[model samples]
Target chain A: MANERMLMKGNEALAEAAVRAGCKCYFGYPITPQTEIAAYMSKRMPKCGGVFLQAESEIAAINMVYGAAATGVRAMTSSSSPGISLKSEGISYAAGCDLPCVVVNVQRGGPGLGGIQPAQSDYYLATKAGGHGDFYIPVYAPCSVQEMADYAVKAFDMADKFRTPVMILSDGLLGQMMEPVVFPEITDNEPEKDWACTGHGNKRRHNIINSLYLKPEELEESNRERFKKYEIEKAELPEVETYLTEDAEIVVTGYGASARIVRSAVNAARAEGIKAGMIRPITLWPFPEKAYAETVETAKAYLVVELSMGQMVDDVRLATSCKRPVRFFGRTGGVIHTPAEILAQIKLIAKEELK
Target chain B: MKRITVIAGHYGSGKSTFAANYAIDMAARGEAVTVVDMDTVNPYYRTADLGDIFEKNGVKLAAPRYAGTNLDVPILDFDIPGLYAEGRNLVIDLGGDDAGAYPLGKFRQFIGLHKNECDILYVVNFCRFLTHNAEEAEEILREIERACGLSATGIVNNSNLGFETDSEIIGSGRLKAEKISALTGLPIFCHTLPDIPSCEGIDREGYYPLTVYIKNVWN
Candidate 1:
């Protein structure tokens, strides 16, 4: 079916996609570069017979998502860096209770409330451990505004399919850039939430949603069960986009905005007759280990470019099993690296290592 | 007699893109153009980002104090009144909708002083919601006029779906713009279309071929 394309900002497109993906409830607090998501939802949700709540805090927003998702409703909450930090506790709680919800972290520069520019500094916070527990949420890193819209639907589906919290890990660049997007046709194939804590009406046993299991053995059982699901996810998910990686000497790797810049740099290097390739992780959590390993046979070295201080570089090293030398190039505190800067790094790598 | 154009519209309605293009065009035509970024609501994708292009084209850019500084401070720091007194052709890029237009009241006195010389242009994109129809468009324009204490003298039909814009989209946008023009008794200032081959069948009256300066990464 031909869908009418429209020019939309990244945040607006993501919000509209979530609504079309059967997201009935949206809870968010306004933050820079991502407030358009809440603004779009406020105008859209009510008109579509849904709920849009501007919660008092990020904590309240994610907890509202948790509560709403417990009723078998597709619920979502979005925030930037510091706000996402505030939401970590609630996210962990939802994960502990095995609830399916979508959390969008349109990240900004951060260790604290850093700056309001695009940054992928939260790779660890998102892919490694969002909160204190040993839980992993499937993280999607979209490089384009169209991908931003596409992943919103996929994030919700993955959350429901796995019965676990899922995250769309975007940065300020993807959250703010305007581009043309056509939404996917939504099929109403919602998974049956038989474990939802809706009132049983005496026809079935009342289901209770709780994260606190006082018994250590029960907690261990829950943790072990979640890890088993992670293993299945690692096999079924882990999407990666490879560009000209066959018989290339240098493989540049990054995700989100960095990947977009790296793609351009790879093209520039190719134009100069350098065997430069790229591997972009669409799914950041499973880390696309197999894709990286596949390129290891042909790749001489790896260049990991990011907007942070070498967070994803470690993953690339581990994915390749440290066979190839993985070097990182990055800029922090809200500064974006240009394609020329990345191209310079690639040229240097070719001159030093490729020789 | 300086021509002061203030571009106001709904959010994501191509205000910054139009303002940048207009300023660049005026400067290229040997007008002393000064483009002021009065957008305080949105932090990204403002006219200020085109400062380099403006500089190269001999257009003065009056960006906010906090722009490109990595500071998360929302401060209105443009000297619109001072820029107005320079007698240069002034093109002000406002924020989106009523909330974004509220900051325009800071230079309400300059707009009031040069009421005859000032041309407040309401950029309309039928592709956007809330202002998708004539009635809704008029409602938003009224809200913007109230918020800025300045009435729009002309309407710019800048309806586009980014890269997917075609003649059909342009025709639909024109129909909506005509309705808005009829409802508000405002003249159609111009229709903004990209310099694409598909725009051949569209009406050429008051047609301004737009050079899309604001772009995403992949474009």
Candidate 2:
């Protein structure tokens, strides 16, 4: 038996989920659309004997998260679009060192000083390697508050499980939206701190955490090992929800908030005699490329829609390998896609799809 | 186009303040000059506080977009597209020590592709470490040269008496310039002028040279 329903905002659920995931260290600053996360952590962390630091800046906050994660403690940070750009360097370092830290981006409009409103413009920065050099970060996108809570817990486990940095690729709407969520119970058994920097208390030797493999061959070997981890990750990580695809000829795909919009369009498209289905990605990084390809094999066409102007579509297209007609419709810089608008495109694509 | 002259010094030195005021003096001279505070290490006295003043002087400012400046956060990507492509000079005020400036390593790949149009200057205070002696100065020059994968062609000798200037900005500066000259064989481009020059401080670095037009100069 489990507690089935509780009202929660997406941001609030993420914060609570991190706690349930055994994350006791939270370092973050207050920013739009995701402020609720920091606020919730501030209140809950204190009572739970956890560490919560409201850092002076987004840069400092991310570093604080880095420092805690370095100690092998479950640590996290949350910010919006502009703030995410500031944290890219740290995120890159985290990947370079293979540290487990959870970073959440309630994306907003961008390029520079993008608005505080909701947008998925950070798709490129998150899914693709945003930082310099070559290392892959596991990115998770949660379209609903329920997934936000579940992913929050899973993000920490995945990070610890894979020894990699994981990002919750969210948007302001998902972050701010309120919905009924049933969170998992806090577990008694925490992961072992075999690799963390927490002092061994006169153990065998001192622990040094660094990404500097000075020797060319040594660094290259380390990079190769990281890629090996990524290869295994790709096999195990696939998150998606499909609807009404038994004989659908066209598919509408999206994630985070846009996925919600695509769901509505999917329902309407079906009513209009358009054989349209919906595909929402739950994990953005270990991107469910297999599911995408499998769905596309029988479908006549695919329609990709997002708030950002065709960023994720690139990944979608690459996954599908141009097997079917893959089209895109998107808005950049703080514009949300509407269900009717997406259905109209779905209708247009289904016309060809039906033929 | 805006102009900026980076003023660098050792840890606990006043170079950042000097760079900040230099931008201020340029603005007073009716020149729009913004101080691009690239100091990633230091927490206080950054060029960020002068954003409004520089803006008023037509001197636009740019710094890491941190809410606070002291944290050791990774430097953000500057998205002012074409700043490096400018035909005018832009000042890149840096933090103390070479390691403080190590972040430019990532951008070196991009900068190298555009080296045909940009200028990079190393600011030195003779009394500081590494630049305090000719041998040390040579080592410092070598580090910046190698780190950026570009030699420091221009030098700014901001030799100061540590808030106790002799009312004359000459002896200390001249010695440092000579050392830089003898060491790198690069020209001592300019030293701090008691009276700052005229130039709006905006535009990204490499656009134009940040110059302090000193009268009665001796070098």
Candidate 3:
């Protein structure tokens, strides 16, 4: 059947898609760039027969998500940069407890409450260490409205399938922008919640959801089990979109909104007889390492672009194992780089490296 | 035809989105269109963000001087007044709330000089706060009108729930639009749908099919 098309902002699309994905509860606090998600959920959750609560703080909101997810219901919480910092402890706890939940970090400029503008500076925070732990949550960085809607549903499923938290890492640009989106039909076969904490019904044993493990050996075992799931995810869930990568000499790579700019820059470079391509990471944590490895076969040099000060460049370097000269271009503290700026950079890179 | 249109509403009411689409539509119709971004209140979601989209469609943009720059200050371009000349269609995307509408007071003289050819449209989204009902919507409308020193000529019902909007919600918004019209004595200029002729309960004349331009990378 044909999907339904609608015009929606990124935050609102994420919220609505979560509800349609059979998400039963939403817990979020108000923060700029992402406040629309909570506001959208306020009006939509009630109508969908779901729970929507504005918690006292971002800490409370993510903890509420923990509580809801412990019960095996599709639960989520959204926040911006500083707010996500507040949610880190609970995110770590949810990760520790092996509870499934979706966390949306519609990132803003920040090392502090920097600004209410878009930035991808949260790359390390999301990929390396979102909280005080060694656990990694699969992060989906969408570059369009359609992906935002599609990833919301996919994030929930990935969370449940692995019994771990999954993040939809977006920025202010994606959160506030409006676009036409076609939503897929709601899935009919929701996975059964056999391990839910539903009062320990007569047929099943009591399920204890806790993160604490005084025993190092038990914690080590738990960590090992989680890593096994991560290994599976690495093989199965690394997503990237390659644009004009075939027989190209310069490859530009980025994620989220920066990737969108890179696409335009690559196209403009191609129009001017420069063989430019792009590798857009759809999943930031898994990092799409193989895609970079494959691109390196034809591409001579790579330019890593972002809205932050070269955070994802490290990942790209590692993905290619520093086989080629991987350079970086970005702006921090809420500054957005235009396509013209990126195109100029690409032209310069081609002249310098293609020699 | 010469026209000066102002789109104003509360934050999250989709006024910027509507203005962007309206400008694109007019430009596609072969009119010499210029869109002014008077939205200093919202630094992120504004017509300024879609300068490339407007330029690609042959629509001229008159945004803040510091637009697309790092600074978040409101610095209107000197050429804004030139956009109001005869025989060109101009769209002014006003900021949300009364504070956002205050910028329009600067253009009061220009609007008054061309009052017969000008229209200030109060875009309403029934799903947004402070405009969920007729009473609340009218209150905000009065505040915007008082700030701009011009009354709303008509109401554009751009009610939506993002991706969840349907015919039932669109049909329900018509009642709220009628109520808003009743309270303010304004005609329902049009109802906006994401796709035209495909959605039920919307007829041809009073409905506009919109192509949403100002969108982020995600939906």
Candidate 4:
């Protein structure tokens, strides 16, 4: 089927993909930057004969997702920053039960009820396990509208493949931007229904899906097994795109919308005498470490720029392992740094590195 | 000091009626009391609304203006205008149970931040959910505390059989109160009646569920 072309907003693509990927249930609150996802689902999902519940709150929305996902059907919920914060407990529980589900965090400014603008401020909260335990979710950071449309299928697959909570770590820009996208043709991926909580029936006994493990040894075994799966994920799931890295002396790196901006910055920098390349990590949690393995060889120093105050810098620093100094340029609270501003930083980095 | 008391319980447990009486009593005592109608589940129980007597007394009623409008957003918005610091009470009349209590989660972190002035009273009906048994009551209490981020919760046995509530049922409620007190270690602050001034209250009011009556002709 010659890929159908359509002008699509990022949020609309996500909702459409969720349907095409066999996601039948959706629970969400209407929030800015991501309302189109819910609105699109509300109209299309009902027509598709799926369940669309505009929950009492984000907590209720996530809990409803938890309930539906526990039954092992494709269930999802979407929200922005503060709303994502409220869903932390349910997300952690999903992780604990090893349930395959997707959480779309269309991030805005945060720490509190922040502004409804694009921001990658949730880099830490999304990557580092929050909410009260040692559980991790494979976080995917998509840069373009194509990935936004694409990952609704990919996230559920990755989540099922790992039996982990998979995140499409997007910001307001990716959530709102309209672009050309080729939606995946609806076909059966045929997910395994063995572990799902869709009623045990007479198959054997009750299949209890819970996070609580009362015995210490029992909990210890689970924690160990979860990490083992994470290790396998760490080895396999690294993604990035490198532009002009052949003889580049300085690397400009970011993810989500910041990567799109930094890509523009790199194009501008190459026009100048500075050989700057942009490395965009599409998968954030099982971070694209392989791309950064030879950081000292290709680039003298890596500049990690983002909308939040040096959030992704921590990951880049660990990936580089201090072999080369990783400089950070960031602004907090929903402020977007222009390509011109980032190019200026690249110029400064070229001056210091080439010297 | 003015107290910001949060009255919370499960669905159909008379939380709003109890809250209304408490606010009215405080108002009648010549004290400035603000009653926020934070019941998101049922809008009809809201006593202090747009033009109600409670609103007439600057009661500051904050209930969801309509249904299905952002359920997670607290039904009643909170506005503490130097009235409370001046020794006036701020009583937030909350909705029932975990589903009802969810909108309050956003305020929970703030409650932890304050931790001093705000007090949450888990309004228990010896009638609803796990409150009928000691173990069930303890589990419900634990669930409420965990969900609400509340370390301390006082109880109010609003265990009346609606308009027909009587003394014997109240006695059974007292038995529940004793068991709950032992289980959760929280004291029963008060019990409620259905404004029954003289006649014995009914035993089967609970059997009468609140049903919506739609006006119609034969179709």
Best by DockQ: 1
Model 1 steric clash total: 0
Interface quality of candidate 2 as DockQ: 0.01
- Name model 3 segments beyond 4 Å from true: B1-43, B46-121, B124-153, B157-219
Q: Mark the 10 consecutive residues where model 2 chain A has the least summed lDDT.
A: A1-10
* Stretch of 10 with least lDDT, candidate 4 chain A: A1-10
**Candidate 4, which CAPRI tier?**
incorrect
- Please, what are the lDDT tens digits per residue for candidate 2 over residues A1-355? 1563544557878898898888989988877768778877886899899998999998898888878888988899999888888888888888888889999998877778756667888888997865878987888899887889998888888898898889999987787654556787766445786878888789658777788887999999999999999999998987788878666688788888888878778888778777788778888887888777888767898888888888878778888887888899987776666788888898787666666
Interface RMSD of each: 2.4, 27.5, 6.2, 24.5
For residue B142, give model 2's deviation from the true position in Å: 64
Better of 3 and 4 by DockQ: 3
The residue-level lDDT of candidate 3 at A120 comes to 95
> How big is the positional error of residue A1 in model 2, measured in Å on the Cα after superposition?
12
User: How many angstroms is residue A338 displaced in model 3 relative to the true structure, after the best TM-score fit?
Assistant: 1.4
DockQ of candidate 1 against the true complex? 0.51
Which candidate do you rate higher for lDDT, 3 or 4? 3
Question: Model 4 RMSD to the real structure?
Answer: 20.4
Q: What TM-score does each model's chain B reach against the true chain B? A: 0.93, 0.68, 0.91, 0.74
TM-score to true structure, per model: 0.93, 0.61, 0.74, 0.62
DockQ metric for all predictions: 0.51, 0.01, 0.12, 0.01
How many residue-pair clashes does candidate 3 contain? 6
lDDT of 2 by residue, B66-152 (tens): 723223254744632344445334566666556556655556666566555445666665544224555766666676566545555
